[model samples]
Target: MHLVPLIECAGKGFPDGFYEFKNCDSFKLLKEAREKQFVSYLNIGATWKPWHLYRSTLPFTPMSSPFHKLYGHLSDPVRIFTISGEFTGHRIPLSEDLLNARMVMEAKLHNLPEQVDRQYSSTSQSTASTTSLINIVDPETKDEVQFNDPDFRNGIVTCAALSLDGHHVALGFGSGVVELADIDHQHTISRFQLDPPNHPVWIEFVHGSHRVAAEDSEGNVTILSHDMTAANLGNLPSGPLPAVTRVSDNGLFIIRVPRNTDSSWYDSLTLVSILGDPHLQHLAPPSSNNFTPTSNPPILASEPSTSSSASIKSDAVLTIPHRRTLGFSPGAHYIGAFDGLSAFTWSTSSGELISSYRVTDFNLWIMNPAVPFTCSYRIPDPVSPRPTLSLTEGEAAHTHYSETHAGHNLDSSWIKCPFYVLLPSEEEWDELTMLDIHSSAAGRTPLFGTNGKRQRLPVSFNGKLEFIIPKEYEPVVFSGAKGLGAWYGDRVPFDPTFLYSPRSSKDGTRILLQGWQTAPIVVDLSQVI
Candidate 1:
């Protein structure tokens, strides 16, 4: 588990004083755009100025436009910045502000929808100036395509997803309307309304296919294609709405649904297969205190069952509670889920529990189904100074002298180190020790140097097990105020600050890491990992 330092950018990169990276900022790794080497993120600064961060090998160039804020605060002003590289010559106004945006395959088409205001009054002067539009910009030519729908004009966009090939973009609106638009034609290809008109919570384009699945607040999931053809995945039990729907690159659709019990709220990870029978696998870990065993054993994919009804079958069930973090391995061989306490990985092919770990203060974990080990990184505190240098040089020396004179004192600084632990296997936890890897001099090493503390990990955890990182992986870490601090895995138990989650590319080769109050750092996973 080694980390390499890559490119790092500060908030000063933006011309305006919009320096902080807020949680609302959009950070994504483009899957289908022509700029394969670049990653995109949107920053809505404190000054109400919006800036787009497109990271590439080329030097950083400030780009801006006169666009309304996604949230549309009255104070936000329009500004202009230059778009370079593949997006050169594109002078797009931020006016078509996107609540959610995704990259699609490059295509030349016309008749893009006009921007419509969320207020939706044909006569309102204010509404005319603040209409929200979806801008599909060509990465190669910098040409811009805009789409505005009557439904979305009056409503807010809750979520969006792009197809694997990037030819289509699926948008979920606040009005429970899901629209599929063709990137080439810049028009709505298909539209479907959720029966009760519940706001769409999650939307995803199935990987390797054109089918799109969207879930509403009513716990109903509709699977559709670009042509509005519906695929019956079966009915879901009446429970809390799913947190997210993940489509593996292999085209496996998995949903993280919540089930309320007498003791606590638990999550169920349900897997729906497109090719075979609409088999559903339910995985939930047993509650901490309620050890009562159920009459039924954990279900597996290979278990023979005779139920052919349209009703979904619980093919496999685990005792662990359902987690919002759910994912499948690269080849769809395994599924993984994480809660606050632990991470569970299972074999999708055999329906066997592959590995599970009781993470100590889990911040973020990354694993490929093809890989044998799961990598977990944690930061003790984002705001605290590094423990190795927490004290001034003179103070550190004085403290060391005081401790030394007090007769064989043990330094407690190791507890403050950030963690980057590798759990080789689920069964190997007992053999691991925090003290085995701790070094009194570790803080002085290059890995824990000042620059190393600010490095960010590129991989993002989408609650899907599929990752762009390979078996032998090297992750890039950013340095400076915006960089991430990592523990050396020497500390046995520590609380983690889940500040920002990292995102990975579809092919598992690149990652986008958003730091606190800083621009996103894009790292090429192929280079180090």
Candidate 2:
């Protein structure tokens, strides 16, 4: 694997005037800025700035000043620039000083509306008015706009998603309410209440459409359209609510329902088509032994089974035990799911399992749409024993051909597919090991001076599979890089933290890695492999 360092900020030491090298626990990349040939990192904390990928660091714009104290807890902070893109929203702390400072700077910089509303927090001093603001700077016009919600002033927002068009945002709150906010006018367009006693567990804006999908803790999936029409997509068979719901870029939705009943062996992963039928259908991974289909168009169940409660046929059902992670290929042609130890890929069109591999500590898997390539080859004369034939063809054909092939020897290649999978190193497994320490300690006898003699768990790359495309296909190859410990120098043992989930840029060209005790590492994929 090839490693290219793009941007590295000090985790322990830094020069004066620079943001203190505190543990960078979280960060997000500004893809909008990236499109403008700039790479910016929004490090969560006092230091929030944009840096140029190729030039000197951009000017640091501090939201906090020494003179004023920002009050109150911040909820979700969202980016409000892109017209049709994700990553437009983020959560920022709710501070009076920060809000007012941002308001003044935005109004002056973007010529926004001048009327600033000051509302006092009931918990704060009566003499002081706490600022509660929701502001975003328009990327196209550089104008700042404020979006206001009564709930923002009182209720706590649990989760939020910004629409691709940047025209709307959907926010799920702890009060069991979901709200759609219009960004241009800065007001709530609509609000829908979920079943009582259950807060929203997940909420997402369906891409390429004006719809939103939200799921509550009660295992109920709610679909909200642009017209404010709300419909329940029906709760899955009585079980634990899905761990998470993901909306593919193509608008298909997937939910991972955990196994709560004794009859089930593993969690059930289901898929739904928001643009078509809204039924929740089970997604089963193909048998590991049956990676390839037996036929061109695999035979499907002849009729829907009456024995099953699902509207879909029994043979159509795909089940994977303990499957938690789910992802759709770029164009929705394939769906990939991973249990803790293995990964499987399924063809969406034929409802057939295409590939399955044992993976060790799978971190990230990305399958871009298959690109088509055409290769033209000259037809050699079968009767000719010319040595020149070696120049055009790498090797001689051994297959016996019918009379029809007597004149033809040329073949044309049609399509090529590429994919990438990232795996974590043994050191990355330290978090898991720490959790197992208690169980191991209970099973072993302690012996003084022999502590260092205990055998360390062996690390294996067994299930960690990497793909190699054939040379005839000439597909784009992605290299993998693991082990960030070497980058820490003497601070290896004290690394202490790592992001549970690494954040990737919108274009998937860059990834942002932040941890509690580590400085943020931004890896540029374009420069790597």
The estimated TM-scores of all candidates read: 0.41, 0.41
Model 1 agreement with the true structure over 388-435: per-residue lDDT tens digits: 322232233234223222311111222222123333335433553221
Error of 2 at 197 (Å): 6.0
RMSD of 2: 20.6
Task: Indicate which candidate wins on TM-score.
Answer: 1
Determine the C-alpha RMSD for candidate 1 after optimal superposition of all C-alphas.
Answer: 21.3
Task: Tell me model 1's lDDT, rounded to 2 decimals.
Answer: 0.34
Task: Give lDDT tens digits, candidate 2, residues 1-529.
Answer: 0001212232223456434323332111221122223222111112222222211121111123210112101211212221112122222222343244334443443333223322223233555332322153211111011223222212434445545344455656545666666544544566677765355655677644357787775778777776755788888553322243445544554544443324332225566645344656665544333443222112133221111221222322122222114555444445655433345555443344444555332323222222221211122111111122121231122122122122222211100222234333465445433212211221211101000111111111112111111111110110111111111100101001111112233333332222211112222332322
